[model samples]
Target: MEELTELVQKYSNFTQPMIDSLLTEIKNIQNNYSYRKFDVFIDVRNDYSHQAVVVYHKPPQVGVSLYQHKVVGKEALQENEPGVFHALETGLPSIGLLAETQENRLIHQRIYPIKFNDLVIGVTIVESDISNNILNSFRAKDTLERYNDVSATIQLFGRLDLAVTDQLVDSILVFDKLGNLVLANKTALELYKGLGYIGNIIGLDYNNLSLDGTNFKSILNHFLKVKVSKNLVEKKEFQYLDHYFTIRKLLNQENQQLIVLIQNVTEIKHKEAEIISKSVAIREVNHRVKNNLQSVISLLRIQQRRLESPELKQALNGSISRIMAIASTYELLAKQVSDDTNLASALNLLVSHFKQLNDTQNITVKSQIDSTIVIDSDRIVTISIIVNELLQNVVDHAFSHDQAGTIKLMGIIDHNIVTISVADDGSGFALDQVSTSSLGLTIIRSYVADKLKGKLKISSDSTGTTVAFSFNN
Candidate 1:
């Protein structure tokens, strides 16, 4: 056994504690059935095929040895010993299987999967005395009966394969037709322990188990009955012992069995709550900023009313427009569920405000925008200011007092590039007449070239003028 442990530790990925536990369990099994021989086999995968190697072998004292020679460290092909490979692959026990040993002696074997952390790490093979006919016949019959019972029970419970169920980290509870708890895996046991349960809980009636202040058994009973009439399973979440849990109900109609799957979602629920709280906090911040900007705008309006100089009033109004443009970005952000704003929507609001402020009844403003052009708040602010300056330039300089004209705002997206243009069909100016140092033009040029990393193109002739900006998506 010590030699076997050393080999297992060297070749397998199992920890030392796991190896010790396995050795202890194996010793207990050997001690309980002293009349029978036992051998432990581990599946090893090579480049070609899977092989089972004998790591430990114990022979019966009163019977003829199944193998005349030492069988430890022997390798058996998967095809030759199907029981070992079957238990390893299925994570289920294989009982009463007859197979030939390395020395050509027939042996009766019961192979059980050894599990750790919901994984099949190895197989434990129990060999009985095959030379005694009466004993062999009785053992084989009993094993076959037990296997049938287990197969039938599993089929009644939605045919859930124990091989897969044993590997799940979620706690599962299965109840029989009479509401007796029949199955609970290691995770389920640990979870029940956390709920203040002690000792073995198997074969207990569902209603007999005590849970502090929770009607868990009644809830299970209600769901089991409700599922039959409504054909709807209930899923619920609750807190138990400071941990959040989600319970799912599954019913097997054939035998009226019930299965409950419980998942601990404490961490996941906490993260969701944190995200929602952050979103609310950000929205409140945006609202406060918009209010503060509105207050500043109100103060500016009062100052404009008191000022007698037209030039000073005009300059104050320009500052107000720029501040309003920033406020509009925050307004859009406050109303949105996400951090991004629709460029078309924000620009449309800005354009409407400018038209009302300038009172442009002769110059008709038309917008041809791609509705899908949505951008983040920062880009929205920059683009809003650019559009505001361009539209102001057209309203103030493009048309005469008596002449009526059309100003068009165009936005288009092709492939991944975005292009926005402001064009006017009114009196045009020569390219050389437009000063680069002018405040409005300088703002537009600096924002386009520096902030947007885009190119600004201005074209003017005798008929019309157009300013277009192109940038990456």
Candidate 2:
């Protein structure tokens, strides 16, 4: 106990007056206990000894206190007891039991470690009386056993607290009623190292945390005033190593800690701003393109009226229809503003346009389609062109002037494969009689086979001509 007091007195961070008062109380405690024949030795190194107090019977002097007694010698401390070794290694407490005769010869010895910070700091070596050896052994064992029990409990608490502390993402700055940092984690240590603060953050004042130029005083003031909060995110615009961050605050009332969660939002915020700017630019471009296409369609109508020959007029009409097909696809693209175009919707629009062109109330467009079928813009345009040609073929060849017939258009999409079929109940063609000279039929076959990387099947009987194609979705 005296050795512990002396070490505290020597290396303590407290004021000198506080150390003296603590030492006085320790001496009083020892005296009240009436401990005898015990020497309190603090061994920081094997060769060095600091004897603080010794209690003994047989009156070396009648009224002299343990601290006033002359210190005993070099040879007496030569035994490198395990208790002393443990104390030097761990900065905790320990005890050593020795049976030393009057002749200053050692007989038997046992070591007990006294732990602080889960480690041994110092030891008390008790020289037992020869007559009461058995009684003293039992007493010593019981004392050491209790000390171990208390020490282990403290060690476990320290370890558990340390583990939980390290897991916290926020940098915990703990304080008493008076602010101070009693404990810190690996993050706190690294932060200080980066700042070139060589001293440990554990014992520093909580309000004095020097993170760059931002101190903890104002944060501590706010914390003390308002202890509970839902969520407090403070954008401090703090800079570290030429980078900026917003300091986030989290208060854990259960543990009474003020946690600072530092976040860098500079890059993320900039990226969001850039995306907004680009979206505005793209929308404006699309609006201009839609207007320009409408103007071109008007100019084409003016040019079609001036044509002379009926064949030339028909060719110009076909060209007008083709341009209108592409224009309609873009119109849908502009309306949805989606990169993934609904291929089913686009095909339905194209079929409607072809039916209108033919002026055929006889032909009916039936859609058995998965509405959720999605294809890219380019693929949708290609599909639109193909559908237009197939429907035109049915309008021209499949129906007679006297007999009107119903034409069916079906689209089926399964997994990655898309199949579209145009079947008509009109004058059907023989396989040998089919020719590539029909402009609409030729365009449909070429697009389905070459561009789409798909196969086209044409089945014609007395009832109808059915053109079916399977392509990658």
Candidate 3:
């Protein structure tokens, strides 16, 4: 049994040459066994021809040798041959006659099972005479099947797992504890530009690739700073035409091995730089325009007092003030191109200018303004005229009833249109009772409808009059 077990292990990977050697060795053993005991020898086996060899031990026959690899009948032993047929079919042991001829052939055959572990494999046919004892065949079979099961399972699972793993999507990679590339997926082939070093990392030893691991430590430091996921490492940075990546170390759930993921982030970095450059340019342009408009306003105010008539002097002063109001709005816009104009700041400055001009500190002006709106200079100029005209009307007519009242100025922007209102609390005026029309209100109406392309609404209640206007920029 032990001898059969040894044979099973040794000849597990059966080949044609090994089978020929086994047949010759058995024939020699049989001849020695019979000749020493009974002075006679007998042997039988299929030869190169389709016919079976049946020879008596007394005289050797002149024919094809039985030791040849090609066993004649069916490229193997004949399937109809009793012991050989059953042994090959079920990988089990059997014993039967080779031939029924008197002096033609009568041999004893014992079959020994070949196994990997507990699995049944094809049997080994041991040919001898009837006296050699056939009980050894069953014992050999029992010993062979004891350990072959595990070996068969291993072989089967290995083939199936390899087939399934080939169909994965992303390229998976593995590295040894020494940081050598060991395993890689099919996608890695395309990713590495066909460098043909998927499993070896091009033999780049850490000492060779990095000077005392400095390069590796730099990469580790970059990754720690970014702290992006191990799977999603962004531009940690760009190098020449390529980009270097930093990824966190991850442990594989099944193998507990370390891994890192790499990607390119060159495009996003370029876009961020472009946006910042454009914003800076925009802010600079806004600053220059604001400075230019303030210079023009200063020139206009200096020339206004030279006029002789009181009406001409007042008209020039009003125009200069409106221009200054718009310049103030631009000043705020130039400070933050990223933020926008502060309408409240512009309103406060406009009210302060009017109070200075009237030389009346008692006029209480309240303002409700949204500072976030980014209105253009043209819109600001138009809105300044509208507010100036409304406030002038309040100061001239609303307070003329021997009463002091508060004025409220509010501004709001929604979507692309900005709405502004100037209202005063005082006695109302009758359309039939009023005779003279002011040139400031006439210019305000023309600018709102034609130049600013806006709508205006004026309502006179018992408390006071409200002037509202909206324009698009």
> For each candidate, what TM-score against the reference?
0.56, 0.48, 0.46
**Candidate 1, superposed: residue stretches over 4 Å from native:** 1-167, 186-244, 252-257, 306-309
On TM-score, the stronger of 1 and 2 is 1
Q: Which pairs clash inside model 2?
A: 91-121, 92-120, 92-121, 93-114, 93-121, 94-114
Give the clash count for each candidate: 0, 6, 7
Candidate 1 least-lDDT 10 residues: 207-216
Please report, as a residue range, the 10-residue window in candidate 3 with the lowest summed lDDT: 205-214
In the range 66-157, model 1's lDDT, one tens digit per residue, is 66788766676554565666565556665655566787666667777778777766777777645677344534544444335766645544
Question: Which candidate leads the pack in TM-score?
Answer: 1
Ranking by lDDT: 1, 2, 3
In candidate 2, what are the lDDT values of residues 244-278, reduced to their tens digit? Answer: 45655545454555555444455776686677677
- When 1 and 3 are scored with TM-score, the better candidate is 1
Q: In model 2, what lDDT does residue 388 have?
A: 73
Better of 2 and 3 by TM-score: 2
| Residue 63 CA displacement from its true place in model 2, Å | 68
Better of 1 and 3 by lDDT: 1
List candidate 2 stretches off by more than 4 Å: 1-255, 260-287
